[model samples]
Target: MTLRLLPLLMLAAATSPADAVPADDAPQPAFFEALRAADLRLATIAYRLTTANAALCDQLQPQIGMPIHALTQYAPAARKAAATTFRFGATIGVEAVVAGAPADRAGVRANDSIVEIDGKAQPALPGTDAPENAGARDAAEAAIANAPVAQPLRMTLLRDGQRVPVAIKPVAGCRSRFEILLGSGLDASADGSVVQIGEKFFEGYSDAEIAVIVSHELSHNILRHRARLDAVKINRGMLAEFGRNGRLIRETEDQADLLGIYLLANAGYDPMSAPKFWREKGGDIDGGLFRSRTHGSSKARAEALVAAARDIAATPTRPIIPAVLATRNVPLR
Candidate 1:
C-alpha cells in the first residue's frame, strides 16, 4: 500500500507555530511537486511496459496456462460488522492463494481462508509487518515454490462457511514481483507500477478501504496512464525542464480515478467504498487547492471517484481494453 504523509496543515498543527518554516524550506511542497512530476513520468513509462507485459501475458496465458499466484485475507466477522455499519474494521488476517493459473482452474479462489499450509497450522504474523516478512505473502510464496512439481498440493480452507479441502498443482516459468515504498499519500503512476497510500490518512480505514486504495493504484498500471504521461513529457521535453504541463497532470489524475473505479469493481470490491474511504480520510473537497501540487482536495477526489463508481457499477460485465505494456522497470521496492 502507498503511504501519504500528513497534510502540511496537520503537520503544522502538530508542531509549534514558532518552529514552522517557510514552504520553500520545509520539503513538503517542493518535494511533493517534484515527486508528483516523477509520478507522472513513471506512469507514462509503466503504461508502455504494462502494454508489452499484457501481450506477453496473453500469449503465455494460453501456453503456460498458469494461475497467477495471489492472495487476500478477510475476517468474516469483521466483514459482517463493516457491512452492517458500512465501515471496515481492522483486518483479522489474509489468506494467500493463487489466481488465473492452472491452480485456480482446479477450483482455487483467492478468497479462500487459509487454516494450514504444508501440514502445519499457519502461524499468525503481525499485521503491521512490511509485505516482505517471511510469514507474510513471501512465506506463502516460498511454500508454494517448494511443493512437488506437477503434483497437486493439498490445501485446507474455509469456503462458503464450510471446511473444504483442495489440491493445486504448481506451474513453472512464471515470476512475481511487487513495488514498495515509504511515506504516505494516495497516488498511482499513470502506467501503474506503484501506488502511494498516505500513512497518516489510513488511521481509521478498514482492510476493504485499503483494498480500494490498492485497486486504485493497480488501476493506473492496468490502464497505462503512466506511459501516456511519459510519452507527452518526452514530446515536450518536460524531463529536462523539471516541470510539467498542469492540464496534463489533471487529465491523468482524472483518468486514474475513473479507471481505478472500474478496476476495483472488476476485482469484486465495492467501488462505492472508494469514495467513502477518501471522504473518511479527509480528502480535499475543494480539489485540494491547499495542497494542489501533491493531491487534489479530498472532497474533489471523493466526488470524482463516486461518479466514476456509478458509471462502473452500471456496467459490471463490460470488458476493459487491455493496456499496452512498456518495458521500463520500477525502481522503488
Candidate 2:
C-alpha cells in the first residue's frame, strides 16, 4: 500500500513563502518517470529476494499467492491529453514486472495498458469521476479473486496501439506484499499484510543492504508482532507517544533483528549485510531518549545480528523461526 504524496507536499509547505518555487516550476513528467523507475526497480528486487524463501513463506502465510508482482502507474487525464505522440485511455499502465513472476511469465511487459480482463471490459472504480488508472488494478484483482489457484487468467493489454491477449497463471507465494512509498524519509513498516517502503531508503544502500531492512520488517509481519502485542494486552497507544512501555518495543526490535538475519540467509542474501547496515545508517539515528526507549542502541542491534548469523551458519539445514524475548512484562526503560 503506497501512501499518496500528501506527506511530501506537507513537508514542502514548511518552507518560507519566498523559498517556494512558482506553481509552473513544479516537477515535470520525466521526474515522475524517474520516481516510477526507481520505485519499480526496488520493488522488483524486494519481490525476488523475499520470494526466494518461498518454502518458509508457504509455511507461515495463510494464503499463498495471487497478488502478482506488477507495479502500476496512474497518469492523470491532463498528462494524457497533453501528449503529442500517442494518447492512452484512462486505463492503468504497467510500471514494472518481477522477473519470472506469473505476470512476467505470461508475457506482460512494462508500459502495456491493461484494457480488459477475461474478455470483459473493467467497470469504473468508485471515487473517480474522470477516467482512472486504478480501473486496471481493480479489474486485475477481481479477476485473480475469481480465478482458482494455478488457473489461467486471460487479460488484454493495449501495447503499441494493439490489444495483445495474454494468459497469466497464478501461483502460490508467501502472501506478504511489497510496495514503495514516494517520499524523502527513509522508513519502512509492515502493516500485517504488506511491507511499505519509503523511496529514500533506497538511496545509499546496495540491493543486499536494502534486503536486510526489508527482511526485518517482513520478520515483524511473520512473527505477527503487532497482533501478538495486542493479544498480550500491551497498550499500543501508550507506546506510540512519549515512549511508554518502550522496553517491550525494544524487545520486539531485538527479536526482529535476530529473525531478520535468518530471513536474509534463507532468501540466499548476504546475512552479514544486516549488521553492517545497522552499523552504518542505524548509528545515525541512535542516541535520543525516545530512541533508547523504542529501540536498542545500534551497537546492540548489530551484535544481536552477528550472533544470529553465527547460529544460522552453525545450523544450515534447519528452518529458522522467530525469536521470543527473554523477558516480558518489564517496566519501560
On lDDT, the leading prediction is 2
Q: Which tens-of-lDDT digit does each residue in 1-333 have in candidate 2?
A: 112222223322433354333343443354445545555556555555555554555332212122321222233323332122113432445555656777788888766666776777753222334533444455555454455545577877777778799987755445565666654356677766677766666556778877877887877776667766666566656454244456566667777677678777876777788889888878655653226667777888888788877777887674455344222233223
Error of 2 at 321 (Å): 5.0
Q: Report how far off residue 15 is in candidate 1 (Å).
A: 20
lDDT string for model 1 (156-211, tens) is: 65554575676655443212222322242343232343344443223344656655
Which ranges in model 2 have alpha carbons more than 4 Å from their true place? 1-26, 58-90, 118-120, 123-148, 237-244, 287-290, 318-333
Candidate 1, residue 24: the lDDT equals 34
Top TM-score prediction, candidate number: 2
